[model samples]
Target: MDLKDEFYSAVDAVHNNISFEATTANEISTFETSIRFLGGLLSAHDLSGDARLLAKARDVGDMLYKAFDTPERMPIPKWDFHAALDEGSVQGSPGQLLLAEMGSYSLDFTRLSLLTRDPKYHELAARITDLLYETQMTTKVPGLWPSHVGLTADSLDRGSDYTFGAEADSAYEYTAKMVALLGGQVGQYEEMYARSVDAAAKYLFYRPLNPGDEDILVSGTARSHAGSGAPWTETSAQHLSCFAGGMLALGGRLTGNKSHVDMGGKLARGCVWLYKGGPRGLLPEATMLVACPDAGDCAWERDIGVWHDALRRKYGTSKPVEDVIADNRLPQGWVNIYGGCYILRPEAIESVFVLYRVTGDRKLMDEAWEMWAAIDKATRTAMANSAVEDVNPPGGKRLRMSDSMESFWLSETLKYFYLLYSEPELMSLDEWVFNTEAHPLRRMLS
Candidate 1:
């Protein structure tokens, strides 16, 4: 328990840095706060049987719950906990969900319900997902979901683009884990996970391999929007989307599905490829046009009508998608179009840890070891670890530093590394499902 004690002590000290008596409402960032703070405290309580952790989780969870107020379909943003004042956007179209905010609350909230024996927290988290299901009842994409949505907007069509990054990353994660955490008590999550994955396999799962080689299914966005005559587009995968592989692998390994296991292995390999092939062995935020080489390419006055015209006007190109991809390949001074910084993100190696636990391959461990060395070398600073602003420095040149170190550095990154590097019997994948924030919830799989 030495590591656990150290972890608890370090995190406990963080509370002293905040002011409970501050006059202003602390900015409530649901996406970050829920995963790092609420998820951390709750998971610690689960793992250590610590009541203090539960109390902190309750306080923070209730404080952040203030954002859920509003007539809008999604939670409002940025509430002052003490003042009861909200400063979330006034321009939101009703019902449009921020995929990250809307989709990623189940772990902490469900755990809160388990601890408190109150269903309100579970219902609170479950309701947003119910809304997502309702939206799918009228979806534009057949099997895939838009990364963002407005509750009552014009029905989404097959041709619109979607993402698995920043504005939307963790929704898909919450789905599978929620059902697992609740032991199928909340069946909607199960339905949504199955439906989404089925749709994705048909539309977004790109198996870039020969007939019989080990499967390397790259999971990305699926957009079938074409002029009346053009082809559907498979979008590029992001570093963030790396989480999909682990989810699939864990789901497959837990359920005994060889296909999902194969795809999960492949997807994990694909994300690692981004880091290995990147300039400094640090994954870029986006991998541009990798999955969509000729997306929207059509001839005979391809019906891409208005959106195509708008694309041309914005970027001054006949093939906007291709142009955008090309631009992403360029490197600016402090930033790269494909997102140059290594912002202490943990999704790739997190998947690597999952893949290793699922498959027991030593190669993944060696790769992860090297990757960790590169990151530690690049990100170390005197005061605290900083994000690398531009990792693509000249040979033997050091990376530029950014001013921030995100909380995931502790909650997910360090946690995964510790677990991954530990003995296999500890927190084994067969026994637990971790939420997007890397909080392990212990449960016996069906």
Candidate 2:
């Protein structure tokens, strides 16, 4: 496995051929480019101490720097690289700006600044974080920003829907990670993370009414009420939100909050339960669950009449409650499968790896092994593993295969799986902190 020749050959190819000067795509995602390419190159250079990798990373970093040329200096989520190069200026979009896209750039740019001994990169990234922190309390829901905001007119309070899901997940994640990456010297990162996570736990975290009455928590969405009432919680869960467990656990360890660590374990276990609950032993991309009134104290509703009544309230007389139940054919607590496909996402395992590191829990590793076995058996293809169309198919039928494999399948999913079994000393959390894409950037202080 120590194929040095192959590694150098691949590096040489990238160094020689890869260029951001002429991208074929009309537009590129700043978040995706920063995390996948810039973060990857920086981590690779840190591991190999190779000048070429740093050079290539610098090239990518320069291209990404063009994204912050807006009038307000806030980065445009999507950058037209060629157009910007030609015009020597960039314009911010008038549409809604995603929270994750705008907020997830601090780590990569700050790392680049440290390595290159340039303050400009860190300064540019810090401006965005400053804006986010300033606007955090002004949103409809204090301490939590919506999924999107208006950046062109400098309005950060544009959207109302809130969730720690796809569009908004990594914003909170970076807040905690930035605390580690900068050696917690900033203080504001920790404050921002603490406030946001506290709000999330109060409004978004809930216990599912599973038949086993498992003591675990799942993050859900919340809608701010029109008046001064509490935000209404939605019981739907997303596979992407699985990262909250690791985020919370890491933040707790960094900030000396034992409660966050305990809650994190509960959240991590919920995903493990979902993996084991599915027919394929893999979690669906998204699912709806019946929530207990109090997440802190929950007991399973044993009466089938309650489930029937809940289904009736959800579906009405449009369809028989029995048919609705049979159509989903899910476990007792799961009301329906919003997204049935398993697209080889890494969020669940990412949390498992992190929790194991934070708690030294061997049981988490065993659970991870079971998940890997199930996923391999169901998704293995001749060339490589493919995604399955249905993770909870009825009647034990075969899972339909899809010809899609995302980059994170390797960068994050398998990396976390491998690290779970590796020695604890290898990439220990004390010495390294992972970005959203699971790239392990070396911590400045251990």
Candidate 3:
């Protein structure tokens, strides 16, 4: 529509309100702030050649510089905006750092630097990627990094749970995308991505006993320690994990690696398989992967729905339990499955857009349509769209509707749906690669 002036004025107000030079009372964040605000400003400039947008992007980039003021060169996941006056809780070693926040810093910064002719922005961007490289190198898993890291805590060498979902998902995505954005000029990203693909294949990927009626393989988390390996757990892959397929496919297409593309296709189809298994045909926050293995022969022979207390006392969640039973839970093998309501996550359909774009697979397009219809049937409400509390109800029958809508629902999921079904040339993948948040960043070679 003819809303360019309104959009420009609105963005101008935001630009004036925010003091990107130094922190005031606002807190700074990466995944939320950078991916949306910064991504928005930079994207606007690129799309419309608006100098005002570029200026705002530069200011935001400068304001974000304080976030990187860490000893280890790792950007603090969150920054205190008032650190300019040295107020409460400044940026430094984070108590807990999310991988997505730490890892997904580059595209916006890189764009800012290229446009502004500033080297500092590039330096800041490089440090985050550099830290990601070193952190993955030290991790117990060959390619995968832990989901959460302390200012200095280790889960594998110590005990923190790891999963390639939610906060950790975007980090891996940025790696492949940075490679595409910079055009293979950077070898480190491609190298790290390759290692991750291989490691995921060997460790995280599994053939699970699922409702699909066929032996279907899906990727989950790897729970092995140094000098010890364990069988993959039955953690139902979250819809967040669905992005792996697109990320994989992007990596493969950029590098001419068929195996990566093939693996990505499987993961993408596996996500569709998840939708197929749901009661209402809408994807849940999570889907059942492998059925949880029995705790033990006694654990199984005793009861079907009850867990064996003695088995828990015996296993104690160590490497020894791998051979006994992975994801040993109360019973029924649902211990790994978080039967949460369908929360309209974007990862599944997001991947469909990518796979369809790359392979031109019309089947993926059809799946996207099916998913859209299911979402419409399940989520439409009297006031506005709402997420279902459960998908088990027929036609979303008696489903409690959430009043709130996630930003990604508009920015990403539905956007992907439109693009997936739109002309392939509208936003051609050859000219652009989206940020983890689905903001289109033009692929420019320097």
Candidate 4:
């Protein structure tokens, strides 16, 4: 099968099977809802030139615009991204990615607009991008916060107070990447994208989260640090893994920002140290090592294997890293429930691929295949099993599906999956990316 065909088949399985869209808002559906499924849909569309996925992405984007009806429609009164419209209105950081997601979708819509001359799609997308940029751009100390648009703008709105470092960083990365995606097509807007990312990196990226702290702290702000009242440290192995993976990509490929790469390496190394109980000052087993003071303190069993494997392989360990992971003496299942290890399987797989890409190692590929088998077996159930839910072995299951299933997850996850699996001759990095982004339908009708 051609690359496009294979991509389409996988995307179809995800779309028909996966419950949430790529930019899925758990219960709240107004945020960047269009881009939620765009990456996956775009991938499918690029492969088959099937208008269905393109139409679906456009339809969802249009629905979001209509639902918002106005800029007022986009903001939830309370700070909740997951709350249904009927449940309650929330304005907070959860939708930061939604804002960027919308930006990405709009950029794609712009492409469609240029290609097809569809003013409505093009105009709506531009408006959405403007609205999010206007609404989210902030001017606090650090500057730029991915604030959740308030639904009510009422006196009662308390707004979400805390933001993690990972989310904001991702938004920054997305902002730049999205712009770069279209800059070749639209010259002027590329600067806008560059400026936004530059601002984020300068103001938000360099600041210390846990000053004088043992673990290196990074905020996972869905927006800029200015938006989220307080910066929260992201301690979850999964969060770090994704963060490192993204930084590695952004720094290495996109902007050639070595600082981002260096920082990613630092964070990756720090995560390993923490996992190995190194840096004697701070205990690796401490649950609340950073801002996550209330999470599980023990090293997770199911995820530890994967996490340790990733860390070991990423750092180029000689023997199986699991030996050290196992020696850490973490309580069994400590990481399984609280840390959400299973949700990290794809991430671990991606990390292996990234390492392989950089180092040209075959062991990483072998490791990734092994990890994929575990994920396929344990998590791939037909109906409800589209997501990786935290399970307690024999019977217990965590019903709620976290944002881990979003498009970013799928995009990065499958990008690696296809890159590693597809024959090298069939893969051209630029062409592969283009297949996902450059389609006639993606251009709007002028």
Off by over 4 Å in 4: 2-33, 36-41, 51-62, 71-104, 128-137, 141-144, 150-170, 184-244, 262-341, 344-370, 373-415, 423-427, 432-446
TM-score of each: 0.78, 0.95, 0.83, 0.54
Better of 1 and 4 by TM-score: 1
Candidate 3 lDDT score at position 221: 74
In candidate 1, which residue ranges exceed 4 Å CA deviation? 1-26, 80-95, 152-159, 207-215, 224-231, 289-337, 382-384, 393-398, 444-446
Worst 10 residues of 2 by lDDT: 87-96
Instruction: Using lDDT, give the best candidate's number.
Output: 2
Please provide, for model 2 over 291-323, each residue's C-alpha lDDT reduced to its tens digit, 9 standing for 90 to 100: 875555666654455556778887786888778
lDDT, each prediction: 0.65, 0.85, 0.70, 0.40
Q: If both were scored by TM-score, which would come out higher, candidate 2 or candidate 3?
A: 2
Q: How many residue pairs clash in each candidate?
A: 9, 0, 2, 44
Error of 1 at 390 (Å): 1.9
Candidate numbers, best TM-score first, in rank order: 2, 3, 1, 4
Question: Which scores greater on TM-score, model 1 or model 3?
Answer: 3
TM-score of 2: 0.95
Predict model 3's lDDT versus the native: 0.70
